[model samples]
Each structure stands twice: as C-alpha cells, then as structure tokens.
Target: MPIEVLPVRPSFVARVIGADLTALSPAATAAIGTAIDTYSVLIVPDQHLDDDHLLTLGKTFGDVEPPRNHRVVQRLKHAELADISNLDANNRLRAADDHRRLDSLGNRLWHSDASFREVPGALSMLFAHVVPPAGGETEFADLRAAYDALDAPMQARIEGLAVEHSIFHSRGQLGHTDYTDAERAALPPVLHPLVRVHPVSKRKTLYMGSHASHIVGWPMPDGRLLLRDLMEHATQREFVYRHAWRVGDLVIWDNRCTMHRGRSYDDATHPRDLRRVTTKDLSMLQPA
Candidate 1:
C-alpha cells in the first residue's frame, strides 16, 4: 500500500497511514523520513507493536539509544525499552508517595528527551499499549514555528546564545532529590545552542525547556528569566499540538526540534502502559 501523510496541525505534525511499521520497505522508509522531516511529529494509529517490532522501527531512523543506566531502579525488564508507567515491576500500582512516581511527575514539565546528555537525542518513538479513559494526552510544541515567529530584535538577541541543561535541574523542580552524589557526578550538565539549525531540514528551532537551567555567559537570574520567557512563548496555543492517545497508537517525534510534556491522568485507578524507544542523533556518532 502507498503511504499517506496527513497533517495533524497547520504547523508541524502529521498522521501517517498505509505502511506496516514492522516491515517497512525502502520506499516506505524514504516516504516516512520525508514526512518526518517535513512534519516533526508523526502519528500512526491502530498499530500493534511488541518490543522487537518497536526496536526494528526505531533502527530505521538511527542508532537506538540503549536504555539509560538509570539511578532509580527500573521496573521494566527490557533493556531497550523505557517504561513510562505508574506500575511497579510486578505490574502493581505504586503508592502515591513512591519516589519513582515522584520522579515521573517531572514529565508534566516540557522537555526534550536527553537534552542534558552530551550526545542529545534525535528522535523518539512511543507506543501506547494501554491508555486511560481521560487525560494522558501528550502535548508537543513546534519550536521551528516559535523561532520564526520571533520579532527581529528578539531573534537577533537569542541567535547566538547557549544554555546549560541538566537532568538534576529538571527533576529538582518537582522535589525529586533521590540522586546520589555519584549519579550527579556521572550526569553533569551540558551546553547546547539556544537556537539550533536542523541538519537535514535546515530549519532553525528554539531548544530551551525545563532541562535548560540557565543561559550561558549571563547572570543566573537574568538567564533563568530569559529561559522561562522563551519556554512560555514557544509553547503558546498557536504553536502547539495536543495528542489524545489511544491503545494501539504509535507516535514518533523529533526531539531535536520540539518540546513535549505528558498531561495528568488518573494513574492510581487507570492503567497507562506505554513503551518508548529513542535513537541517538547521527552527529553524535561522527568522529569530532
């Protein structure tokens, strides 16, 4: 079947149809890649994918990032898939006071995946195997449009600035302080340009998010204010797409040019099991 790409938003998201994600042909792969480059988010609905199937689809884009050596013990057994759920290892709901649940609360804040890593993430694929009756929607902001919408003066002011991002800073905002000294040492903050140009599409995008602590070479107070301002501006209603998920839905997003957050859901009473596989940026694999 011929692949079809239908826009979900005027700016940057689309729904792709008529391709088997598990057994994509070269032509289908090219079409999907082009769709992704044109629309940063692609939603493929009513699809069933196991871990192996998810991994196969993820590798079509780039190197699938290994599951993080998380400081917090992981409940999921699969090393390739990140568990984005409220259940424990035995699939029981965690207590309201569970530290893992607290850690996941940070997901409510807008963030780009792996922004704090030296080699930032390129793309992320999330599959919804179970979804709640209400809420649990994921919201994505189009940073490309956000960058273009800026006034001339504002654009010039931020064009060359960089920001320092850290996992500690983002998680700290939600009162998650379980990281040990060694974990902190291993995952120190990294710097990335506030305005990034997509290597393929050649479009520029704003990269600030919850993980972005402060601007480089600026006073802490001023830097934080600027970061907050940019985040607010980028996530305005006009530049956003809110996706209401359903079971058997697969959503892929470019982390390099977007910021996303999970909406609140009734985790204690409802099950919302999702699996995620991410690919590393190609540039990260290149020799410096």
Candidate 2:
C-alpha cells in the first residue's frame, strides 16, 4: 500500500497520515524512503513507540545508534540512543547549560547533528513527550534550497572548497566543562566539501555547520569570516522551516541535506521532555 504523506509546512516537513513505521510492508517502506527524499522532514503524530519500535523504524532506514559513551541514560529502552528529558533528576547535568538538551535547547545554531564526529548522524527522530508552555521551537534550514539560492559566482567559488569541522567548537561553545580533555582530544578536526552531493538522492547541498570551525590552512580570521558569511547566506529565514512542537509530535529530518537548531524554552521555570534517536552516518569525515 502506498503511504499517504502530506506536507506539514511549505518547505520540508510532512505528516505520515496512515502508516506505522514499525510494521511496514515492503511497499510502504519504499514509500517512506521516497517520502524522506522529497520532504526532508517527516512528522508522525500520536504513536507511542517503545525502544523496539524506535529501533525498528530506524532499521528500515539505516543503522540505529545509541553509540558508546552516549551522553544520556537511555537504558530500560536503549542506552546507545539519546533520551532527551529535562526531568532527569539523577543525571549528572546539574548546570542549566548542559548540552544534554541539544534536541530542545542546545541546538540553537544550525548544524547536522553529530557532524563533528567521524561518522555523523544521517537522520534524527525526536518525539516530544512533555513540551514547555513556550519556546523550544525546532528550526530547520533547507540546504539544497540554500545552495540553489546562491548566485552563480559565489556558487562557483565554493564549488571545490572544503570546510573544517570540529566537535571541539560545539563542546566549547558553552565552555568545555562537560567533556574530559581526552574525550575532546579524541575528536580531531576533519574536512568535508563545502557543497556535498547526497549519495542516494544525488542532490547538491551546502554543507555548513555552526560547529564547522574553519577552512583548512586558511588564516583564522579569514576562515571565520568566510564560514560566517556562508552560514548566514545559507540560513536565511526564507529557506527555514520552524517547528513549534506539541506533545506527542514526532519530527524526523534528513541530516544529509538539512541543518537544524533548537530554540530555548525557559528551563528554569518549566520542564520539557523528548526522546531523541540519531541514526548513524556512513559519510566518514577525514582530516584535511
């Protein structure tokens, strides 16, 4: 059966109307794969999926990970995956600025989740459990649109340019109080093309990240200026899709061609909880 997927917003989000991803037929599964390429973001509502269901859904796409040393305590479900909840009373994160809330708060800067790693996440599926009264909106930028919007000259200039990305930059954004020095040192800088060709879709996309620290061998000031300008150009409001989440809303986005961010909610006043699972990326990053 062909699954019905309708657009939620103009640019990238779609709501799967009558499909259960955990128990999909081959044809329905194929439809979802096709839908993901077309929509980039998919929202399936009201289905309370357990760890097995989550893993099953992700398996239909690719590898499911709650990789070792995963930050949150996602066990009883899947420790390897991330469990994003503000009410983790026993969590080591006592400070208000922990990266533990990346799905709802820490991801304010546009980025492909885990893009700083050797194997970045290919997709992210977040299910809202308890949403705060206000704020904590998720923002997504259409990289393909951003790339297409570029002028011919600027496009040509960045065609062959590679940008350096690092986990260090993201970790240090709020100050590196979270990671030990060894953990930080393990993740070295790696370079990837400024523009990437999506392996499956063959679509051209601008690969820019707030965590992208520099251009290889380029002076710090120049690299910073270039990266900043490129990101600004790519993240114009015209190309973004902002999702003001409701409880039980599930958002799945293609990490291959979309950059996402999270707007902060007043964590001090109210608590929000969401479960986040990021599928692994096969596109390995190598040092320039």
lDDT per residue, candidate 1, 85-204, as tens digits? 888777888789887788888889999988888888899999998889999999999999999999999999998898999988999998888888988998899988899888789888
Worst 10 residues of 2 by lDDT: 67-76
Evaluated against the true structure, the overall lDDT of model 1 is 0.88
Q: In model 2, what lDDT does residue 74 have?
A: 48
Report the Cα lDDT for residue 281, model 2: 73
Local accuracy of candidate 2 as per-residue lDDT tens digits, 94-202: 3566455442344667788777766778878887877889998888989988898889998897787778787668656656546666766877777777888877787
Top-TM-score candidate index: 1
Q: Which lDDT value does model 1 have at 251?
A: 95
